[model samples]
Target: MTNGPLTLMQQTSALRQAIRNQEHTGPTSGLATGAMQGNVVILPKEYADEFLMFCHLNPVPCPLIGVSAVGDYRMPMLGEDIDMRTDIPEYYVYRNGEEAERCYDISSLWQDDMVAFVLGCSFSFENALSQVGLTPRNIEEDVNVSMFESSIPTKPAGRFYGNTVVTMRPYTPKDAIRAIQVTTRFPKAHGAPLHFGDPSSIGINDLAIPDFGDPVSVKEGEVPVFWACGVTPQLAIKNAKLPICITHAPGKMLVTDLLDADLAVF
Candidate 1:
């Protein structure tokens, strides 16, 4: 299949199809410009209940957008035809708290007891940021948002427990405040930020080396701004050490049909 110029939403749909057909398998960071994107998790039915509770307990970092019935692969609520097994650009297979393999799709690993989850992603806030002329540095640099595992502890539910992970974008204090106001409208997408300014305060030791995503320049007067990221679930999934787990690869989001406005709250 040929990659061509398409609108954000159209590109997302096409990319999803490409993923399903094994034509395109990479990060979806900037693919669907203004569309709502999501982080995904697939777990066994036995662990679904507790994981759901974990999400409820820590809604900011784990905003639950869609959930599938046990053994179901289709997420009708997210789009006309969103297959959890293949919609995301890439998948990370985990085994006993370890990353086993990264693949384009999960059809070969499907299980009858599996349940899928879709969580809000930071991409939802980009439109708002751009609207106000504070485009994120990650977007400007054309790279994935920088992510780090934070010291902030999450409320545990059963075996699902871990520190929250965050995504960073650098901006001057004045622009940082504007970013907070713009992101506040989409509570499902993390809503504002947990902390800004000092990286050491949040347990991040290095600004140049992120645990995930490429680093962008922090101008002389700019301070790094962070937001609760959907990747938090991946860390939690690792800590859970389930027999098997599946998640969207970092930057490889599940693009949905829902508009950003659909998730905005006043």
Candidate 2:
């Protein structure tokens, strides 16, 4: 399932094809370096409009990247030959707001009334951080980025509503300020952090336990910086209690052909 080391572009294209063929089945956090990765959420047509509005209302935590027509699996807008049903490395299927199964592909569950939405992910900003000499701790640790449920509330749309989920990356106050500026350029990618310093301020009781992803070391003098996370939609979707829903497993993102630089505002 693993290919020999590949160039960034080659790796990304191969990764997508591998996922499609069920070869590389794991999280996509550091894969496809410099590419625009996405958080995936697929819902029935009955809930698509409301979810779309919710994303529009809260663009920071749920920046919209690609939206598919009802029942359509191909997301031509995001990448050439992209198939939403098979492109993601892993997917979580939920029923009645509860996880039902984890699968490599969802083609069998495809419905004529389903629509897929791809929201921008924080991984898009990691490239900029690296270019500026600030590598994310998750990359250094070779693990998923730490994430937590924040007290920050999002605007509700229909039955969809919940507190925001944030991803954490520890940095000294000095490095954190620079990380903020680097991330701000990619508004579509969950732009700049929502908070930093204390985890308790965000309703998180334990730094070791993350609602999603994996925990990394917090070196001395480093503080945990929190950024709006795409996982916010999963919590909102759960609250919505939709009959059925599908999303990318944590750390497993939708790798697209879009370049990271293309997302910068200036």
Candidate 3:
């Protein structure tokens, strides 16, 4: 609580505890540096099968890292003590496929038949990019990475389907190429840029107004780089019009015990 220097694991654990206690409710990006972060999607058992198939068909934006067993809130595969209902800084509750409310934890809303799916997040690759001296502007500004819904549609699976959502980072063309190379190592972390250069090409007309999360400034000489984002699933969840669904708030990811290197291909 005092901002005293804490070790990486300690910081992550403290953040999770604060979240569970409802003392901290904000974006998790650029925090617990080096630890792998995840985007969470929780839904009832009835919707689990179709959602799983949706993730399978859209691997780029939904590379699953861990899944809680039906009726279980713990994800032992992702961390030693990850609690699906309370670990994330913030949660979004969707009713009839629309965001109904945001809360610190989902413990009160969790049901016995609910399942939680953890998806690899671009925040993991952002850490790798930072290590190589290519830190994203959003991190430098201490803001959430800009995310937008795009024209590129995801492959439909059962009742789940929607266009992809993407996160943007501005970098010089030279740095953008290196970022692509560095990010390519973490496939689970949405490896590599989906596109670079003009935002209009991806159906993002106004860089200043992101469909999700805060917008970071794109410097004059820098081009906006786009990466397939885990938030893409929420759009699908919305399209499905499920009775209820819960997801990590935009940019607020679940910090895990696994190191970012554990997800790197090389």
lDDT of 2 by residue, 1-266 (tens): 44676766777788899989989888777677888999999999999999999999999999999999888998998887899998998999999999999999899999999999999988889878988999999888988889899899999999999999999999999999999999999999988999999889889888899988788999999999999999999999999999999999888889998888888887
Clashing pairs for model 2 are none
Give TM per candidate. 0.94, 0.94, 0.94
Which of the two, 1 or 2, has more TM-score?
Answer: 2
Best by TM-score: 2
Where does model 2 exceed 4 Å of error?
1-9
Q: For each candidate, what is the lDDT?
A: 0.89, 0.91, 0.90
Which candidate tops lDDT?
2
For model 2, give the 10-residue run with minimal summed lDDT. Answer: 1-10
* Tens digits of lDDT, candidate 3, 1-266: 55788988898888878877878887777678888999899999999999999999999999999988999999999877888888888889999999999988788999999999999998888888988999989889987788999988999998899999999999999999999999999999999889998889888899899998788988889999999999899999999999999998878889898888998997
- Across 1-266, the per-residue lDDT of candidate 1 in tens digits comes to 44786766777688778878877777766666677889899999999999999999999999999999999999999887898987877889999999999888789899999999999988889878987899999899888889998899999999999999998999999999889899999998999999999999989999899998888899999989989999898888888999999998887788898877888998
Clashing pairs in 3: none
lDDT of 1 at 240: 92
Better model by lDDT: candidate 1 vs candidate 2: 2
Sequence-dependent TM-score of model 2: 0.94
- List the candidate 3 regions with Cα displacement exceeding 4 Å: 1-6
Ten-residue segment with the worst summed lDDT in candidate 3? 22-31
